[model samples]
Target chain A: MKTEKGQPILNIRNLNIWYGDKGILSSLSFEVQEKQVTAFIGPANCGKSTLVRCFNRLNDFTPNFKFTGEILFKGSSLYAEQDATTVRKQIGMVFRRPTLFRGSIHENVAYAARISNVSRTSELNAIVEKNLRRTGLWNEVEGILDETPVQLSTGQQQLLCVARALAAEPEVLIFDEPCGELDPIETVKIETLMRELANDCTLIFATNKRRQAARVSDVAGFLYGGELIEFGATEKIFTNPQDSRTEQYVTGRMG
Target chain B: MNSLMSRPNPKQKFALQSIALLTLGVVSLLVWNVLKKTYLSDVQVSSVARVSDPVPNLLGDIYFFLSISFLGVLLGITCAFYLEEWLPETNWVRCLIEGQVSILSGVPSLLYGLLVVTVFLPYSGAFQRTQGFPPAGDLNTASLQVSSFQGDTTLFYIAVLTFVLLVVPRVIKATQEALRSVPIPMRESAYALGANRWQVLTKHVVPLSLPRVIAGACRAMSCALAVSALFIGIYISGYTIQPGRMSGRFALFLGAALVLSIFSSFLSQRYPLASTRHT
Candidate 1:
């Protein structure tokens, strides 16, 4: 199995999660390499999104949520001591749907920038423009920064969410099915943006589409029934999976 | 756990509908019965606008009570909005303050009046008797002389304070609900973007919740206005409606209620109800 040369940005070990005594994730272990796109693909109820949410403590609000795990980010325990807000700054998220705040398109992109003490308008505008450009939304949304997010198409809204995440300057970007609610054209746009953004930030996305996982990821982790069934380079997993189940799943024999 | 059934059975739905209709019927019947008991005389259009007996006093009553009610409603909305924004549901302080306010909602209006008489009336004189205003308050004579403005600003103070206390819980609850209606996903998105609680609330939650907050304020103001005349009149008229018995004067009171209600309803519709889900 090939791995990135440097230490992984996220290291998880013996991660056990439960919802009211029913185990959701059982002693799962994985490492998220720096500045590479990692994809977790699985059938429904595989705890894919839950694992991504844990990276930023977004799952902290779930009721009857209990987890015992060591998720280390840059050698520090993510859940043990570091403040959730600060953690979120380093590990930004783009949700399944574009959950934009009730504000203008410009404000949406500049939100994370504002919170991290990017006060000056010149700097904020520059950041918004850069991120919007990076997400391929600059031309479509230019000169309309003040327009509310409600007016944007679903595809544009999703792209704006990507721009918003980029504004935080996150080291790790987690996308929870980023194109789940979007169309094919929007999906292609996001996939292209993800390939470009992987050069700068560690991208970990959870998706139900194995084809998408095969398309973009450098490394693919297949999780099934809360277990990491296989983890390796995406091409290797597709071409010559180490396990029979992985081969069968990749060959469309089963979900 | 098993998921809840989506639709209620026909029998249950029928029962619920019947219960709702019955409650509404009882309320209308009760109001009709009260109106019957009052024996309100005919409205004389000529005297309604003129400086006739009972006209001046009721008009003064409307102005005084409405002014204070407006202030109290505004203040209530501000506090509630701030409390919701600054102190979220996760904050222990919010839980405590909201709990107390919810308890206060259950307190009767009569008890509020009693509290005002005993505890508040002493300090009720916020505005002093201004010069050039007579002490007698010309209610029996003109439509509105400056006389009614003087002699015991205390009554106005008591009425306002009591009205505020009576309706504050509803305002707070309404504001909180409005804030809630802005979608938890929006707040979560804001928080996920690294905004502190304060930043997320002020920038996102409050703006989204503005229309609902205004609606809540209007509802509170209307409640305060409708009840103000009753409570304030009890003291002014020496426990009798004799002062308001004049035919056209009751018309003036009803007209004030009608106009204010219409105004507030108009104000509320200015902003269409905003919801993140709708978009």
Candidate 2:
């Protein structure tokens, strides 16, 4: 694989994360290039989510959760001196389950802009509409922007979450098993969206399903027992895995 | 055989039933006496008459003040919630704030009144000192009148300040608990979307928890109203009423207490009672 010389978008070095004396990930490292899709595929409880959370320092909320690592974004250590608010604005995340605010669907999308000092009504509406349309939720939600998101179907709410994430215009987008809760059709829609999103921003996704990882990811990393067992192109990892574990996982012999 | 068996247990059953009935009768009698003496005596009627004409206007004024106090409490809780979210790194500071809130909630209202008087009244210079008065002149008399008005305004200031402190913690705890009940995942998702802590709280947590927060505020408001009535009663009964005067403040105090109690119960109905099955 050719390594880009200019500053990699995100760089993780010997990142070790722990949750209350329990080591979740040890000496794990990776770099995400600009405008590329990097997928993390692992069995349950392998610390994929933990790794993603470290990007925005969300793990700080957990009591006694400590990490010894260097995570650099745009040549700045995200963990050292960078403000969490700024880091979060640059790297958005979409969770496994659909989380909608209690207000109208429009508010959910416009929430980031509203909070970030975008108070002009016309600009706010444009941002909300553009993001929602990009996520393919505008057609369904346009007539009823004022309606509570709780009224939307599960699929619509998930799509709306994507729209909300995009509203912030984050440079590095992370999806944590984003389609874990979706049906087959919805999952396909999200997978397609991820491909489309990769054209503009670096996309990193964590999924337990190997097939989903193979389908959406350009560069895939197989995590096993808190280690990056294999990392390469998606086709190579799926069809011609160097690691036995990766082959077993992709062939359904083992997770 | 069945008839014989039924008679055999009848005596014990009868004794137990008789005991239960006797207990119920005694309890009801005691309750009735207490209710009559405390809530339904002839003195209560006189108390109502003493302030009947002025009660509505006075209560309207009190309600306006109470609403403002409620708004203050709401704002305080919102501030506290944001503080908790923003100062995650400063756990000790959060603990200190929470501890202060609990202490405020537990402190007696009368003590708060005393604290307010000590801290605000003299330091604010609302009370003018007549130390530089001319010797026995007409000017001294005019200066004394000016000082008296200042003292009156200061006292009113102290009273409102005391009331606000007394009510703030109840509102804070209620709002905090409501916010705490929100699922962490919901908040995390908001943060993941690049929403800042304030944005997540106001946009996601606040709206989701508003129903519960509003319910809590209603409860806290009722408690504050009841406590305010007691504080006013004690203050007026001790200081405001003159021995030979009509004791209008005392009458007003009692009337306010009754109205506040009734209003508390009415507000309570807005939230479902435990006796209601659906809730």
lDDT of each: 0.72, 0.69
Report the C-alpha lDDT of model 2 over A1-255, residue by residue, as the tens digit.
Answer: 133422378888998887667888889777877888899998899989988888877786675578897998888899787988888888988888988776788788988887788999899899989998898888888999988988887878889999998898888888999988889999889999999988788888999998888889888898889888888788999999998988899999997
Clashes of each: 1, 0
Task: Summarize candidate 2's per-residue lDDT along B73-174 as a digit string, tens digits.
Answer: 767677657654565622555545555665567666654544333344435444343222223343334323322333334434445566666667777777
lDDT of 1 by residue, B127-218 (tens): 23222122344433322342264444455555655676777777887787787688877877887888877887678877888899889877
**Docking category of candidate 2:** acceptable
How high is the DockQ of candidate 1? 0.47
DockQ for all candidate structures vs. native: 0.47, 0.31
Q: Candidate 2: list runs displaced more than 4 Å.
A: A1-8, A60-63, A102-104, A111-130, A145-147, A240-248, A253-255, B1-79, B86-90, B96-165, B182-186, B205-211, B227-229, B236-279
